[model samples]
Target: MNSLKGHPKGLYLIFATSTAERFSYYGMRAIFILFLTQALLFDKELATSIYGSYTGLVYLTPLIGGYIADKYWGIRRSIRWGAVMMGLGQFLLFLSASMLHTPGWAHGLMYGGLTLLILGNGCFKPTVSSLVGQLYTPGDKRIDSAYTIFYMGVNVGAFIAPLACGYFGETGNPDDFKWGFLLAAVVILLTIVIFETQKSKYLLSPDGKQLGVLPDARQQALSAEQAKSASAGEQSSRKWRNLGILAALALVFGTLFYLWLGNDWVSVGIFTACLVFPISILLDSSLTKIERERIFVIYIIAFFVIFFWAAYEQAGASLTLFAAEQTDRVIWGWEMPASWIQSFNPLFVVLLAYIMPAFWAFLNKRNREPSSPAKQAIGLLLLSLGYLFICFGVKDVQAGTKVNLMWLTGLYFIHTMGEIALSPIGLSMVNKLTPLRFASLMMGLWYLSMATANKFAGMLGGLYPEAGKEKILLGFRIETMYDFFMIFVIMSGIAALILFLLSKKLRQMMHGVE
Candidate 1:
């Protein structure tokens, strides 16, 4: 029945589920930093630090969530639990905002809300992502298109969130923030309802079996046998070696970050795990030579992804602040809320999502489609240009001068195109490259890169030029908007060049998958 159609009905259901979940997430995120500064009464630097750590940990827990899904709960159960936790998290934020008069309870509730969010996202992100790929058979070209569709749902939520949340939360008064948080909590309930009611009927394989069921009994038995094959002494030695390696990596990275950023343990932990987990995947004894090479390709592409996200995620922090304090928002005698500016990227994403996949398809028809890594390299290049565009807009502007909103608008437009190229394509690539048994875990590892980047983004956001605060990075002093934006230009430019050079080698490593 489904053979003639381009995609299954389930894909649309996944789209709905993802859309609701993202609305909940991005809605809360739209004003979180503002909530920190205005409601919680923290400074910009501290708010960005907390913002970075919150976003970073939100991605990091996916590793644990993915592990749990693979080993115990399965994706369906994990997602349900995750949705509930996130809903509760948003509700707590509402309570926190409602109690703004009591600073201590407000602060306590905010942290508690953020904790639930982090744990819940750990469960939700990777599982939903992995599920999209599972909808297709191996070698099906539609996988990329499906993920882009799913990605559009993600952006749909992002596009609307800031408008709704910002209007309610980011009004001139701090007291209004509770309404935005409450809106997010309500949206999450929709996600639970959509998934739970529809999943049994629509979330099925081609042969009519249910998907995301518990691991096969035979597969568990096979794993048991594999464990039995390893001698106790050998297992002990391997465990110690892995621990030693992890310890050494943590020490080296922790010390370096401490020197560079001064005792930001969150960045140190996230960054250290970024390197350690990818390497640990290589340490698995079951991998064949071809599998190992393909895995390396994922690692290589993921390493470059760190730079893309670090710059791109500035939307939620530095860019939002720029919109608030430095951009001329007055249009037709109305000033837009700063948090609304965060919606631009997602708005562009929704517009461009179809165009990008079709563009790739057009290239594929002519046998001219770029390799996944090559496309990602192009994305990095576009990211660099976006920052460069903004750099020009900000150049030589006086301190206290607000530039046109068009400047930030243009940057979001270009960056959205870059994101279209990189983010969903990268998800499609990970699913293509991963072995079936390791799908969830590998997806978790992919997100681990973003965790590191987000933490780093927070550190960079702290460097946003404040009048009294002098922040120096790598011996260069940042004293203006130009200086701050240039960091992304240089960082993403170099990464693009290097990744472009390595793309051919990496494509070959994929062993004909692309």
Candidate 2:
């Protein structure tokens, strides 16, 4: 399992820290919906809406984190402080849960806890990613494989969190939601402490300056290999001209493409921001022609992946609640825990993650592997199919008796296959598309794709009726219980078709980067 080639032990250090971090984050998140709506008697739909906003903002604020990490605090300092903040936030959450009966004080602390988690996650998320990049050198192919390994660390935490936290929140003593919160807080605090004590053993002593803090002595010598650099004044002006051109494009979408007004606004905003760096290259940027083209191709693929995340992220806010209050959970003479259902996703991810790499190697040997876009398209199609499974399964279940756990379990398995196809590999594609100069910015934008997708997923979930349920789909009348799942299935299918049409163009732009 160990792939060794002078990879500093720090990679494993990061993997361990991430595992702990995921356990803490997911443990809390997986149970929060159930605790809020079921235990606290908040309306399910309102709790879902709020959850969506909370999760969306959690991701959206990273733009600020990236700016500060790049310009002021540096990655290590920002990351450490973020850990401290998140730890404190988790602890506050525990106190809030304790005071749930205290009315006003409870509400204040609840908001306060959420604010800290968002701010802390924003600071920690981007910098930790940047630190991973710092662990590698230019032209190192191992970066892709290393990230796959890191993502597994994420799944490991995701897989275990539900079981651990659900036990505290839902099982044994039912009023122990506070116990779960306390446990989650303690775990996060432990992660922060563990990470701090071994900083030197993990990351190279961060130079507290900029993105260039390579611990490897060889890296310092090779820093001269930078592809391009410009004065801040020149860079700023070039970005402006780039904005002017995109503004024209935006006007076209706003005025002429009226049928898709909402989409037009979003697509234009995305396309406009995307156009900036390449346009900067065309203007103040200094690079060989090959570099610009490569970056352009990467941008093309990035726009394509946004749809994938929009479909995949529905699992947390919407789907989790759907399973809880709607779906039948009766199995083996017991009602299944709603929070426990979420573990099925990462459970599938963990089981099948190792299979894909082997399958890819086999495909690579035979030249039978699908292209990146094709693989991603397949993922969407399968995810769509998974949703369809749940829709059909529960279309006839009794009002409160519960849907079988096996359906959720099976659907997660299919969705995990889709994730393996798209998500794990998408990161590698991003690094390939990004040129050295705009690397961090491009990565930041890449995450914005996820941020938008998560919010949209939340909104989609809200469309479901958590009360007075019934439904119609594909011109056939069905239970309202199954309608939202059907909609998601249809949406993912449409996304797949669109991506399929554009796959050739995306591949062409990739210029063999995949």
Q: Which structure among the candidates has the greatest TM-score?
A: 1
Residues 185-231, candidate 1: write the lDDT tens digits: 99999999999999988887767778777742223334656767789
Maximum-lDDT candidate: 1
Cα RMSD for predicted model 1: 2.1
| Alpha-carbon RMSD to native, per candidate | 2.1, 5.1
Query: Candidate 2: worst 10 consecutive residues by lDDT?
Result: 214-223
Q: Score candidate 1 by lDDT.
A: 0.90
* Candidate 1: Cα lDDT at 472: 96
In Å, residue 478's CA in model 2 sits off its true spot by 9.3
Model 2: CA > 4 A from native: 1-7, 172-175, 204-300, 328-331, 468-479
Q: In order, what lDDT does every prediction score?
A: 0.90, 0.68
Q: Write the per-residue lDDT of candidate 2 for residues 1-514, one digit (tens) a residue.
A: 2224546556676777777778878888887777677656677666765676667667655656765666566666777787778878877777777776786776678778888988887777766765665666655766766777777888888888888888887773436777777777777776677667776655652233233243222222313433336566866887787778766765664455345425534333433344343344444345456666666655555555666666677677767876776667777678777788888888887788778878887998999877777877888888898888877777866666566677878788888998888776776666666654444445565666666666556556566564464434446654465766777788888888888787787777666666
